[model samples]
Target: MSAVDVSLRRGEREILHGVDFAVRTGEIVALVGPNGAGKSTLLAAMSGDHPISGGRVEIDGRPLDRWSPIALARRRAVLPQQHSVGFPFTARQVVRMGRAAWARTPRQDDDDRIVAEALTTCDVEHLAERPFPSLSGGERARVALARVLAQDTETLLLDEPTAAMDLGHQEEIMQVVRARADDGHAVVVVLHDLGLAAAYADRICVLEQGHLVADGAPDDVLGEELLGRVYRYPVTIGRHPETDTALVLPRRPSRASSPSAQP
Candidate 1:
């Protein structure tokens, strides 16, 4: 999937301004920025859930509007930031819902196997029997992700997939994403955690107030000056001692200088 010069406006205000982005097979692209930076809006636009006032979204060189809803669902799947259901649906039922796009098609035959695998892959096999509403925040997040995985599309668009998870689950989710990318699927994830993005993303796109400021490898784009300016805080880049990934941390004031630490 690709977007060229994409722009979005809402109720007299422009949210995104000519942002150019694309994700290819075997690649993991991360979108990172502060609150209201248009990350979720951009992802929604990509998935055809939101309207774009200017520019176009394309899949396989064809405009997004040209494809039927089911046809597009077969090619790409989107996992939105919120997953809510009015009915009492079990986690397994929810995951199986992902295969609805192929209901009458030949691929429908594989629904059982695919849903089972998705549940297992997301580490939600145990929760599969429980009502989705009864699951914890982290468990619900994983089940939602399994639904997306079961969609079995070439490209996956995720919005804050780990926002509710613990440290271990966050790493596990990113690892699953990494495996997906390695298996030749395109992955685009919106992440508030810069450290997580820097650790797993092949490329990072930085947005500040809806404008695309930088797009490149994490090491190139996540510098002290740019991050500090965009996030409005002092940051220092360091290396992880174990994984050796780029580590982004706030440059906090010293104890003697900190307001909270004053004697």
Candidate 2:
């Protein structure tokens, strides 16, 4: 899937400038940026959830608008930052909804198998019968993820999927994302954790104020200069001694030394 000169505008305010990027099959790309930088907005546009004011988005060389809604849902699945059904639904029922895109025939056994597999893949099999609204934040997040997994789309777009999870759960989610990419699906995720992005993403695209600032390998895009410039903070980028992955740490101002003391 690819974005071809995609630009989105909400009224007079533009959310995404003429941004161009692509996700090759079997690769994972992470969109990293500060708040209001249009990371989520860009994903929404690419997933056909938001309309573009200029340019067009194409999936497999075909314009997004040309595909039927069911066809689009089958090819690409999106998990927004927040989801709510506003009613009590069993986790299994919620997951079954993902199969609606392909449920042309009455096949209960197939649906059950798909839902079970999705729950197991997401490590939420125990919560399958629980009501979605009654589950904890992390559990609910996992259930939501399982729904997307059940969709079995070739392209997956996730926005801040690990925000409500703990460290362990966060790592688990990243593992799931990486596994999906390894299975030849294009995966694009908006991640706030720089370390996770560096570890999991094959490429990192940094957005700044609705503009595509940097698009390259994580080592190049997550440098100290880019962090300090785009995030407005002094940050140090170093390699993890054990895992050999990139690590980012914010540099604190020295209390003993005043800014005026420097020549």
Best by TM-score: 1
Residue-level lDDT of model 1, residues 106-164, one tens digit each, is: 99999999999999999999999899999998899999999999999999999999999
- Candidate 1 wrong stretches, greater than 4 Å: 259-263
Model 2 per-residue lDDT tens digits across residues 1-263: 88877889898898898999899889999999999999999999999999998888899899999999989988999999886878899999999888888887564448878899989988899998888999988888888999998888999999988988999989999999999999999999999999999999999999999999999998888889888999998899889898889999999777668786676
- Against the reference, the lDDT scores of all candidates come to 0.95, 0.90
**What TM-score fits each model?**
0.97, 0.94
Error of 1 at 169 (Å): 0.5
Name the TM-score of candidate 1: 0.97
Each model's RMSD to truth, in Å?
1.1, 3.2
